[model samples]
Target: MVGDSSYGAMSIEELVKFFQTGKVVGFPTDTVYGMGCLLSEDCVAKLRELKKGREKPFAVFVPDVDSAKELVEEFPNYINSLIKKHWPGGLTLIFRAKKGLPPGVVSGEGKIGIRIPDFPPLIEAMKRVGSPVINTSANLPGEVPPVSHKDVRVPLELMLKGDSKGGIPSTVVDVSGERPVIIRMGAVKVFEIEAITGKTILLSEGNVLNILYVCSGNTCRSPIAQYHLSYCARDLPLFIRSCGTLGFSGSPATENAIKVMEEIGVNLTAHRSTPISRELIQWADLILPMEPVHREEVLSLGANPYTILPFYEIIDLEKIPDPIGKDIEFYREVRDLIVKGNRWLEKHLRERFNP
Candidate 1:
């Protein structure tokens, strides 16, 4: 039994030791307390034996985005979108399990609940363990979930003492079908979930032109193109957003880039970086990646939202040159490319909207 200040105090080695030995440990999450075991066939059996509970479906908690991608079969666009928007927090997603997950974990339901909690201790422990851990409420079947370590029963108390520092459980979301359905609302609110999945009133409703722009960094090319398209379509009606294939969230645009755009009366100072997400793809009627490789990266996320090289249909260029750290000449070159691209896009939009 490990006893210390908080679950965050326990070393990764200690947590891995307990999980690898097939012991269930109570841990904190973003919402309430949860019991977890390594998702091995033998571990699953041992967890069931230890709990002496009915054979109901259970969820699993992963360490990070990459780990979640490995456990489930081709994640749908909607699910990917949700993960990007709500992961590393309390949102638990339930999906149809592929062959890899043990049948007992899901109780033969062909579905599995999975989450990536925001807690540092749990993330570190999962990283050491190298697999998704079984995640269910710490309490026995049909009982209220334990909100704190003190609320857990003696047996669970023993398990935590032996293996973990008690932590909270994550909020759960079921995405096993068409739309995301909330199973349990915890730390993450219901409206937050709706914000990501809900449909908005279309301005003109003809085809609802959805556009996504992708580049190396969202700061310059993609965002500029995004705004350019939106500006050109001000008289027309279209849904447009810009993002990067590998951009950080909430980061600001580059200084020189902003300076140049300011000269053009484009206030990109308010633009913040956002990475390409599953939701972005789903929301887009057309995906305009800056290069072929970026187009491939977008496709790898999931299907739909026909990805294309932004200038492929207009010209034969295969890649967009990176304008970072370049002089004014380089910026001018990029601006020229953007202008050409937008001109082509304008024609395309006219065809789609006017025709």
Candidate 2:
């Protein structure tokens, strides 16, 4: 995720050429190691051979949300909420493919699964290649997918220098239907998908709702959101709490935060910060992390990528500054930002919970 992705001994220039020349590359994803070849006719044939008699079609790695719409014929607006919240992660959306796709890349149903991973190094290569790649886990038919490059058994000319602590598979959903069908249950949970689409999720577990708000210290942004949302959340089947990424246990809210909430007629006087925990992650139906780093923290705690809302990414909400040690005016400014962000979140919640 740092600078140039470690693609074995391949240089960036060499890597770009390798992909452009219809060759395959072995790389890692948020979940497991994978091999991908561009949709060029020759490359797809190579991928097909490596894939080895797998009847299912391969998913494509989309560069971003915009490109996803471009590739999918008459993309559905109903799936926008899920795209914004969970694309570029472990959720692969199935869409109707536009004309002129190569032979074996899509299903007989004329659909293709597209996913934008949360990782950057992998995506950068995709951008350079400027076409969708035949993205699938690097494994033969009926075999387990490898989590690390060393474990990959396929004969790959290029290898990305990376190791993975294998996470869950990308959750595949067919959104082309009248109702979204869970094609495959992977990292993203069923309830999280239901929450985004405003549909009811039914599974083995009963539907007790849990919500988590996360930030740096939990004294400012997240706690403010937690207490305010709590007032309106009473009638719903929700359990709400706030936590910090690097917070101390039982820390009190900042004075400026307390004063600003007072002006809004909300209380932050009883707020105390708690560090994020696995128990909390497993309990939550949805997570709203204040920043990107906090999103990573949630993943570390084993929360599904889709379950945690990358709020800053979801709505293009700019950075909400930490006003913990700043002046009263700074605190007020940051408070205003949180208020604005929370307003949008609340509107979405109303439509989701009530509808």
Going through the candidates in the order shown, the clash numbers are 11, 4
lDDT of 2 by residue, 293-333 (tens): 88888998888775777656555765456777899898888
Q: RMSDs, each prediction? A: 13.6, 11.3
Stretches off by above 4 angstroms in model 2 are 1-4, 7-11, 201-355
Best by TM-score: 2
TM-score of each prediction: 0.50, 0.57
- In angstroms, the error of model 2 at 43 is 2.1
How far residue 228's Cα lies from its native spot in candidate 1, in Å, is 47
Clashing pairs in 2: 6-161, 8-161, 88-116, 88-117
